[model samples]
Target: MSSPSSTLGGSKHAIKLTQGLVALFAFSCGAIVANLYYAQPITELISPSLHMSAGSAGLIVSLTQIGYALGLFFIVPLGDLLENRKLMITTALVSIASLAAASLAHSPGWFLAISLLIGFSSVAVQILIPLAAHLAPDHARGRIVGTIMSGLLLGILLSRPLSSLVADHFGWRFVFAAAAVLMALVTTVLALTIPRRQPEHQATYFELIGSLLHLVRTMPVLRHRALYQGLVFASFSLFWTAVPIELTRHYGLSQSAIALFALVGAIGATSAPVAGRLADAGHSVRATLVALSAATLAYTPALVHPAFGVYGLVVTGIVLDFAAQMNMVLGQREIYALHAASRGRLNALYMTSIFVGGALGSALASPLYERGGWTLVAGAALVFPLIACVHYWFVGRPHAHGRT
Candidate 1:
């Protein structure tokens, strides 16, 4: 087998990642990926403050995710076609401008537009993950990917509480302003520390995207991983979106209280590193089943009698996020190993599907909550992981196809 240094860039050896560089990448991922979730916990504040309808305020998050999906399909593929460092830096710069605009917008319409741009540019996180995989030697890829993903998951889980706390005191706009500063710092650090990785693919931009369909058609592991993660992420989005409203309406918890709940949920971030090590040890299949089962069971507490209350909700949130984080690392470890040259595109497809699931979950959160409350939402959320579990058992593992 060729060393990473020998294989990458036709050099004598692969580009080796220093511990400092890995830490920087992890920091950069968390800082930038937080852009997608800061608005989740503060939707109510945003609506009344901006004089927009509740529905329109929800679009702030939805539009941002939609933009992320767009960027994944359209811009993230460029990671394969261009130099990775330059592409990631450019996206970070765009996120800085978009987030600054978001902080300054007075009207809902303007903010919604800016939110989309924020999501779109935040695809920089996706680019960085694959680049890390590219740099790591084959034996250590899963562990490295896991570490960075732990940071990414931390960003996703922590963003809500941090924003809720910031918005509760300083107003919601301040959250974006704070994020812009963080992005600027991340951009500077990434520009200085990240090694340049130019993929050998010479295809034109259009051809690159067009090949996504071909890749999807040909790769069953990609399809399975994408579908499984997508379903689980949908459940994740539904829980987070609806729980904020639930906390206030049912329990009379304030934004600061919700922040605490989010903080507790951050414990799930531990699963990322654990899952990565499991994959590296060739226990990905067992790890995946655990993730699926945990996801399926995560909502059981929420279904119990009302007296379970906030405790159940907190438990559910912790388990739910842990399951999702674990499953995603396993998926990335699986897909990233499929084709070295195509990691960026594979990640694009995998994440685009996951975000699409998230968009669906967010879209359904309000209606499900209004119609049947948390019970209905919990039931719906449970179905996704259950279905994924079935697939993992019956279809995903044949030994002939691939590990989960």
Candidate 2:
């Protein structure tokens, strides 16, 4: 049997989180995660400035996500073995350097390299999430995770418009330069305000990473949650990455106009907090299904009419983002409940899979768009969530009502 403190750790009555700390984690995560996306909307601006070809511009986005996936697998697992506060601060410092270097990069090779470093260090946000779960009682875990995720989703949604607007006025380089400055502020706040947390598990770095594979094999919950969120995230990546290109190419939108379009999608960030509440109330399975259906349906407008124009695409963005954010928070809530000692590793595997899917989506966006345009991209994007829905039906339904 677990110890009394361990037992209490799972109960809402034992420990409660402060609103200020929660807000700090949320804001820091938003600020840090925004680094990965600053390149997406401004790829058009960056490509020509560096004398790179349009065909290869998507690489900037994909490589950053790829680096994030790698960090999730390799670096995030350290959360289970190290002190959380120090780890986050260290990673943020590295991210600050990368962002600064990216701002000054004069060649495609330099920019791409810096992008990867920026993504790798941005896994600090993932470490912060599990740290929040560790501090929160089990009953409030979902709500806390949702609150932090709301910041993350806002970062993802707002990054586009923010980058676009900044790039329009001050050039794309200024976006990363400004991001580096904000990252420095976030790092300082984290170092000062966040409490230290040391995990109970004792293991070497290799042992921690090796244990991840074993967990994947043993825990069906990790597999299913990761798979479901992975597919939904792929759809999310496909839409956001492709739509920016479409906005410029098809609709002839200026950078500021595209920024406004991205701002409209920010409305979807509201789902994160709501999804958290639903999970806290033991409605994870129901919420997961609704999220999947929303994702699949989000693509229908674009598929139905290739000529549905920019408004239809914006509607699709809002709905897709809502579905993706909701499903992701629900997934994290489920996995975080698995093993208190293993929350960090569990999150590592879960997010690694999701970002792997995201990498695939971003990597494929340009080629698919160039080959067949928006209709093909919409049809291809629909397949991912559809696969997730089928998996949920066949394997995830009966087990959904209870934790696996």
Candidates' C-alpha lDDT: 0.88, 0.88
lDDT of 1 by residue, 319-357 (tens): 999999999999999888877778789999999999988
- For model 2, the stretches where C-alpha displacement exceeds 4 angstroms are 1-16
The CA-based lDDT of model 1 is what?
A: 0.88
Q: Looking at candidate 2, what is the lDDT of residue 1?
A: 9
For 1-404, candidate 2 gives per-residue lDDT tens digits of 01222222344244457998899889988988999999999998999999988766889999999999999999998988887888989999999999999999999888888888989999999999987887776677788899999999999899999999999999999999999999999999888877677666778998888898889988888899899999998989988999989989888999999999999998999999999999999888889999999999998888788777888998999999999999999988888877777888999999999999999999889999999999989999999999999999889876554554
In model 2, state the lDDT of residue 233: 89
Span of 10 residues, lowest total lDDT, candidate 1: 1-10
